[model samples]
Target: MEHKIQPLLNYISKYIVLSKKDEAVLMSKLIYRKYLKGQYIAQQGDVCKYECFVISGCTKMFFADEEGQEHIVMFSIEDWWTADMGSFITQTPADYNVQCIENTELVLFSYDVIEELYTEIPQLERFFRKIIEKAFVASQKRIVRSFSLSAKDRYLYFRNQYPKIEQRIPQYMIASYLGITKEFLSKIKGQLIIDQ
Candidate 1:
């Protein structure tokens, strides 16, 4: 478990240095879990109690519309942090669901544990603030791209950003994430191959 948590510690250390005591406290608070593919780590309408750091494998955060069409919001891979931010922060029901794309290992921290960490380790607060800022920036970029870019451009950008993801997950999920139909994504992929 300690070995699996090194990636998370390294990630935090990139933003803020942790003293030995802070590190121990943070480690103590984490709960490790393994999830199989197709399992949900969080479900819509449930209060999201924990924020998870991926130790391995992949997951997708998505929401189903009234018509029951799933819209992928984001994908998380190894070393990535994932949670429904509003739900976790406000202790409200999540609007999105997080499900594994492959068998996954994660280290989770409850909302209360996070708050305690913030108080116990000031540097951790700074680290999390930076993490949220980055998430916000990424969200803004995705929004801008959706409005400004064509489907092909969006797919291309996504491919560049997460080069390994396409091989791991089904194409339809990628299409959903890009807000395009699977047929359109297939056409785009075909065009790319033809061009090559």
Candidate 2:
């Protein structure tokens, strides 16, 4: 698992350099876990216990509507982080559900463990701030695109941003993320093919 965790160390290094001591402390608290496809990592009403970094595989963060429709907010794949920020920070029930899109391996930090890490390694605070900033920025961009872009354009943006993820996620899931119907997504794809 150390080898698997090396990627996380590498990722964090890109943001803030960690000393051997700091690295050891951070790694010591991380929990390695795996979930098979169709497993739920976090449910709508359960407090999120872990802040997970994807070592490999994919997951979706979605919410159920009054009609029981699932609207995907985002998908996290290899090297990405997935957690309900509100739930994790506030220690409250999550509004979204995070489910594995495929068999997934993750390195997780519990809420308590992360707090300790922050105290032990102050630079880790900066690293996490950057992570949250990126997530927040991406979220804002997604919100803007939703109102301004056509469904076809949104699909194209999604494809360009997540080419690998596009292949793994089902059409219906992708449609939900783009706020379109599955049938409509099919039409958009067919039209794209014609244009190409």
Off by over 4 Å in 2: none
Model 2 lowest lDDT segment of ten: 1-10
**Model 2 C-alpha lDDT per residue in residues 88-179, reported as the tens digit of each score:** 99999999999999999999989999899889999899899999999999999999999999999999999998999999989999999999
Which candidate leads in lDDT?
2
- lDDT by candidate, in order shown: 0.92, 0.93
Candidate 2 to native Cα RMSD, angstroms: 0.8
Candidate 1 segments exceeding 4 Å error:
none
Task: Please write out the lDDT profile of model 1 over residues 55-170, one tens digit for every residue.
Answer: 99899999999999999999999989888888999999999999999999999989999899889887788888899999999999999999999999999999999997888999
Q: TM-score of each candidate?
A: 0.97, 0.98
- Native-to-model Cα distance after best TM-score fit, residue 131 in candidate 1, in Å: 0.4
lDDT of 1: 0.92
> Which pairs of residues collide in candidate 2?
none
